[model samples]
Target: MMILVYGGSGSGKSAFAEKKITELNKSGIPLYYLATMQVYDAEDEERIKRHRMQRAGKGFTTIEQPKDLGNIALELREAKSDILLECMSNVVANEMFSDAISDPSIYDKKVSEEKSFDKYEGVFNKIKDEIIKLKDSCNNLIIVSNNVFEDGNIYDDETMKYIKTLGDINVFLAEISDEVWEVVAGIPVRIK
Candidate 1:
C-alpha cells in the first residue's frame, strides 16, 4: 500500500510517519527509511545528528540521498526492501535551490525572468518519477510531504512561482497515492 501523510509546515507529518514506521517495525516488518537530507551547515548538521539518534535507537536503516533519490529507489527495489520517505518537500527544495544557496549573487540580480525558475519544474519531475517507481517496487511505500499551500501567501514573484510549482507537484502525487492523509495538530485525518 502507498500511504502519503501530508500537511502544512509543523503539521506533524514527520511525527506521523515516524509513528507508522515504529508500528510497522513492532509488527516484525522490515523498515527502510530513505532520508533525503544532507547537512551542509551547523544547524543542518545538528538536525541530521538528532534524526540519526532517533532512528538508530529504533534500528531503521537510513539511506541518505540528497540529489539522486531515483537511483537509491532503484537499488532498494533490487534489494527488495520496504521503505518510507520521511519528507519530499525538503528534497525538492534541496535540488531546486542548491545552486542558489552557493551563489547568492543569482538572487541579488533583480531580473524578472521565468528562466530563473525553470529548474524547479525539472526537480519536480524527478521527484514524481522516483515516487512512482518506488511505489510500484516496494512492499509498503509511505511518503511524507509538506502541505504548504494552505497557509502561505506568496508575495514575491520568485517565491510565488516556486510555491505554485510545489503545489502542483503535491497535488499530482496525492492523486496517485493509494491513501492520502492530512495531518493537523499532531493528528492525521484522511483527505483522500
Candidate 2:
C-alpha cells in the first residue's frame, strides 16, 4: 500500500507517519524508515536523533539519506525490504543550495555556464524516477510531503517556482500511490 500523506506545517504529518509506521510494524511486516533530512544545525541534529530514538524499539531499519534517494531506493530493492520514504520536500530542499532562494546569485551566476532550467529539470526527473521505482517495489511505501499550497503569496518568483515544483511532485506521486491522505490536527482524512 503506497500511502501519500500531506499536511501543513504543525499539522502533525510527522507524528502521523510515525504512528502509521508503528501500526505497520505490529503486523509483522518488516519496516524500513528512510529519512532524507540533512541536519546542519545542533537543533536539527538533536530533533532527528530524538525521532530515531522514538523508533528504537519499534523494529524498524532507519536509513538516513540527505541526498541521492535513488541510491537508497536501489539498495532497498536489492534487499527486497518494505520501505517508507518519510518525506520528499526535504529531499529537494537538500539537493538545492540552502541559499538558492535567498541568494539567487549562487545559481544565476552559473546559469551562463550551465543551463539551470535543464539542471533543475534533471533533478526533478531523477527524484520522480526514484519515487516511481519505490512505488513499484515496496509493499508499503508511505510518502510524507508538506501541504504548502494553502497560504502565502505564490505569485512571488522564487516562492511561486518552489510551490509549483513541489505541487508537481505531489501530483505525480499521488497518481502512483494506492492511497492519498491529508492530516489535520493529527487526524488523517482520506483525500483520494
Residue lDDT tens for model 1, 1-192 = 777888886677777877775665444456788887766789988877876766666667877776667787677776556688877777777766666676778656534344655566787787788777777767777788886676646576666766777787778878887889989998989988
Candidate 2: stretches off by over 4 Å: 26-29, 98-108, 111-116, 154-156
RMSD for all candidates, in order, please.
2.9, 3.3
C-alpha displacement of 8 in model 1, angstroms? 2.6
- List candidate 1 segments past 4 Å from native: 25-30, 103-118
Indicate the TM-score of model 2: 0.82
Q: Give the C-alpha miss distance for residue 178 in model 2, angstroms.
A: 1.0
Q: Note the residue pairs that clash in candidate 2.
A: none
Local accuracy of candidate 2 as per-residue lDDT tens digits, 34-113: 88877668988897887778667867787887667777766667555567676788877766555564567876774446
* Lowest-sum lDDT 10-residue window in model 1: 107-116
The TM-score obtained by model 1 is: 0.82
